[model samples]
Target: MRALLEAAGVPMAVARSGLWRPIHPAHVLGIERALRQWGQSMAALGAVAAVRYPERAAVIDENGTTSYGELDRRVERIAAGLHADHKIVAGSKVAILCRNHRGFLEATLAASRVGAEVLFVNTEFAPPQLAAVLERHAPDLLVHDAEFAVPAGIPAVPSDLAALVASDASAAPKPESPGHITILTSGTTGTPKGAPRVPTAMGLAGLMASALGRCGLRSGDPMVIAPPLFHGLGLLTSMMAFFLGSPLVLARKFDAEAVLDQVEEHRVGVIVAVPVMLRRLLEVGPRDLPSLRVVLSGASALGASLASEFIERFGPVLCDAYGSSEVGIATIASSADLIAAPGTVGRPCLGSSVRILDDDGRPVPVGETGRIFVSSGLVFGGYSDGSSKAVVDRRMSTGDMGHLDQAGRLFIDGREDDMIVSGGENVYPVEVEECLARHPAVAEAAVVGVPDEDFGQRLVGYVVLRSPATPDELIAHVRGELARYKTPREIVVVDEFPRNATGKVLRTKFGS
Candidate 1:
């Protein structure tokens, strides 16, 4: 058996070991369990890392660096404080209303340790929408930073929670498996829903390890946390970094000048930001951002022209990634992939699969447009309210429409929910928006299908003009470029677009 293994090019060490003694299956299982038990929960991971690397700076907040040891101890004490003082119990929902900061991480981990679900309220929401979330979640306890002017009944915890993490390392039971972390994701239709995910399924460790491997982020490598922790991209990416023992310098919020200063000051190597944030950064223009090695852009559909502009200014470091709350990191348009397939969302990650299907749920031929369904080990289970019946057997339709080439490169056309059928022809809003964005006068644009008697549905474009221009002139410009049917029959120029809490354009409210 050993000679046969050696003939197949098996390692000599394994062959010799097998010849000497039979390997025990139980021993392998024991090692797997040991690795798993190393730490799964955010709180537990922080605690373990704190013990393993006591001196390493775990979090760089506005105040200064907070060591892992200090962060871990703070999580414990905060958990204890919530349990003992606030009467919080297992399964109790707690609303966290704050931006990205060291306190946000501490509160999340602490709540996780006590089996409490943390409802991360979108800070951008107006008073009415915020109240709606509070009503829906019905949080047992409310915790916010000093900046939040929270109403009565929801008591504020210590904003600097790192001070309390050391009090109790042995916290109570927490659901550490699938369906623990509840993140909010709005649908193409309906209200914003809660998307729950398992730690393993979300690839909390995998994303970090992969990013670290790609970026070569070691102890000394610097990273900038540009996205807010309240969003899933920020929360999971931060957790990924924490899992792989990476150091990150946190920005209190996304600001172009501040981000540039942070990269220069900390020598930041990696940065993950949205297209809007990148647009703002580019608006400021590159002035010797010497330390940046990699930039990951996601959270919205990226324009090919915009991406090329960014690459021209900042070298070939910017990578466009694609994913949603229901599905974790789906496709990553890596730097190389961008070069090969200029506008593709790239291939699936380490253990994920993608299926592009037609309207009838059958797989479409390569190069045919279809709804993008993803199946992956990293896929989240379902929404928090259990309302999502469409997601089944680890498969989720991202509500986005796209096509995959024979080479498996995914090309997103636009959102499936936002498709407009005019004069028996289908039009994708993203395609229209992309064309509009190419216009020098158009700063931003959104296309939505409106109700129509003759054509079933008509395309109406909402635009934010950069330079002064009339709606008729914009429509005429589009008509000159696109097919007459593809051009928006009606165009309305607005100062700004109506966006959801996470900066996504809301089309349902258009013309209302």
Candidate 2:
């Protein structure tokens, strides 16, 4: 399949052509060796950070902060406890079910120390859903976060079982061991896939380094993480802070007031938020948060008008980035680009290649709508079923539809899965929804492709109006802004649309 994909004729999107500098052969080998060496155990990476910056705070949980030295000690002790108490060792996958607490970090590090991969189960996953994930992954050890205690034989991380591992004095695993992370993808469509987290983490750090350069992140940057620790964005952000020897202040869940308080209290320099969160923050945040140097918004299409509003309110420090779980970091719109382009997801980041491809997997013209494909520096180690071809594909149609402008900036059309084909025309719901939300009366809107006999699939707009906007008025208003064919066929004015815990619209549950 990969060979077939490689043999296909594809022209590079003008935006992607000549955008990246090839890594030196020697440097590539050196980095590969380093990644391999660190793969034996994630603890080696933690050890390097601990030794390099022992006094630096590693994590700032609700209780207090733990320095890198303390974090290392905890990992060593907990890892020993894991092995001695639970008899878990190399090749064991440990399921960690916890909220944004310190135990998550310590348990992950402990599992890594013993060459065990950590399976991060979303705390929000209901009992059956959680059970399904556990059964699928088949973790040898289960670390619940104290609150959830129903699953028999699943030991809590800080329980007596873990205390036993802490009692042991065994050394951490050597480098060159088997891969040590099995993270479940967000799984918006089907079941979540277990993706290797190591490659994802490395790729994210590399991308962050390339885009922000050395000046952005520092030793004590209190990363204000608002996204739940379960999601890829949250988990990877926390891991990057840990890997870089910086302190993370997790919000457990996003709350505008709480986030603002933390930013001021911790003097947080950086924050990673989605586009929606940024809007919410700006709506409720204090007039000034002087310590915040960078505010990163990603995981969804960023709107130009929204970006301008944010900059006008919060000052020019917003960085718009684009990437996914399968392929790590792809493109970044720097602070300058956020001001200049406003809504662009930015040019492809260093060590990555991107192209806009049409339905036939051929690159579209400079300013044409097509599926976005990314060849990234850090691709997943393939799916859990052990298929590396997709991970190594020179170009992967990201299943996202978008177009590139003549200036090489990418504008998202919408997810191919979410695109509504109405009367033989592709109608991107995001574009229409964004247009609807801009109205004076509408506060929030979600556009979904619904089953329709005539059009194959019709666009349905679910809106949360701040004031009052009838369905007819909204439908007419959208028609004026968008192409008549692209306008939503139906507008449903409701208090709210069903959203996941992360606030992403759950279009699948429209009828139900």
Candidate 3:
């Protein structure tokens, strides 16, 4: 453990902060009972929070606030209700398809308490995609919000916040084994795959230490989570809040202005969101949000222009985290690093090993691009379909192409599959996209390869413009900054780009 901590670059003082603080005898007893009931899983994190900060607010959602003590009791009753009425016993797979709110947490905790594996369904899934996921997972029970339409033949229960908390049953079900959490990958390239994982004590501790040291976040600080909880960034932040006894403020939907309002209302110190959310928040223009100390951006690339603009307008609160669903968090770049390194994704987090590997799985030299592989305790073992990512020397491939600088900062070039071979020259769309984004008129851009009789493959750029800019002008701008072959063959200016729930541009949806 000491070596792992040191490898992660975590200071010894931060490592000591992972130790348990003194608590009252009564709280200790409650924690012990929770430990015996839920084992060392995420459920136990919630249990410890409830005992340590019973009077503090655990969650603040659209419905109102829930104290930690109240949340604990509600989870117990919901667990009992699921067991008594739904027959959700140990090993049962409970698929939850709700937005961010108290009910989502309630259903998750309740399901885990009974040793049932929890699958967090993406709320933005299309009907066919949702149906296919349901068919594939074959969950025993589905707990969902009233707003969504559930597929026929699944035993589903309503997840209304009021109704769930008003249940009469107060007894918690004891799980036979620790429940596992399954987070689905964002299907930007293809069908989303499930990454199932069981949390270990050492893994959780390392994650906590790295997050604390990188983000400068302390336990018990109020936090606002703006991304979907089903995603890796949101889920990890929520788990950290529970473990640290921090109050989590959630919203059913993400509205940029409303997020600012909530931060001011709750005096939140940390704001967790994806890069698109940060862009939207900045679009709302500058305002007084003094309580916000850290802005954690993840789930997608944070382009250099966007990061600089955000930090300039909102102070040095922006922190970019680079990772994926398969591997938890690998690197975190602070505001200074964002400005100094520009497009760099910062250094590896504590207890994480990141390497750029060539085709033969050999390490690439610094400043050379290759497949990004990471070895971390928080990485998932495999997908639910019994398939796993390629592992070399205990390191798992992140499916991203990147390189490290002489300063040890990591910079993502693009997705390995997104590389385009045009006119016998290799081009990464991210480089072109970044060049286009630096233009004053461009708001967002996506580049994809299309079939061409002459070149075999050609680059086509789709852009959403904030102001007026001709296609020819944008193409010329890219040509000026990058190689002629790397420049888009054609540029199309559009009002908007097709994006997923988390605001990732759907390159597959780009029209020919």
Q: Each prediction's TM-score against the native? A: 0.73, 0.72, 0.80
User: Global lDDT of each model?
Assistant: 0.68, 0.67, 0.81
Between prediction 1 and prediction 2, which has the larger lDDT?
1
- The list of candidate 1 runs beyond 4 A from truth reads 1-39, 155-158, 162-179, 205-220, 419-512
- Per-residue lDDT tens digits of candidate 2, residues 122-180? 66554555666777777787777666654554544542234644485675555346445
Q: Write the per-residue lDDT of candidate 1 for residues 166-214, one digit (tens) a residue.
A: 4453454444441166776564343557876546423543344334333
What value of lDDT does candidate 1 attain over all alpha carbons?
0.68
Candidate 3 lDDT, 314-345, residue by residue in tens? 99988988887888889989888999999988
Error of 1 at 451 (Å): 20
Displacement of the residue 439 alpha carbon in candidate 2, Å:
36
The candidate 2 region of ten consecutive residues with least summed lDDT is: 10-19
TM-score of candidate 3 versus the correct structure, residues matched by position: 0.80
Model 2 pairs in collision: 40-177, 77-166, 80-165, 81-164, 81-165, 81-166, 82-165
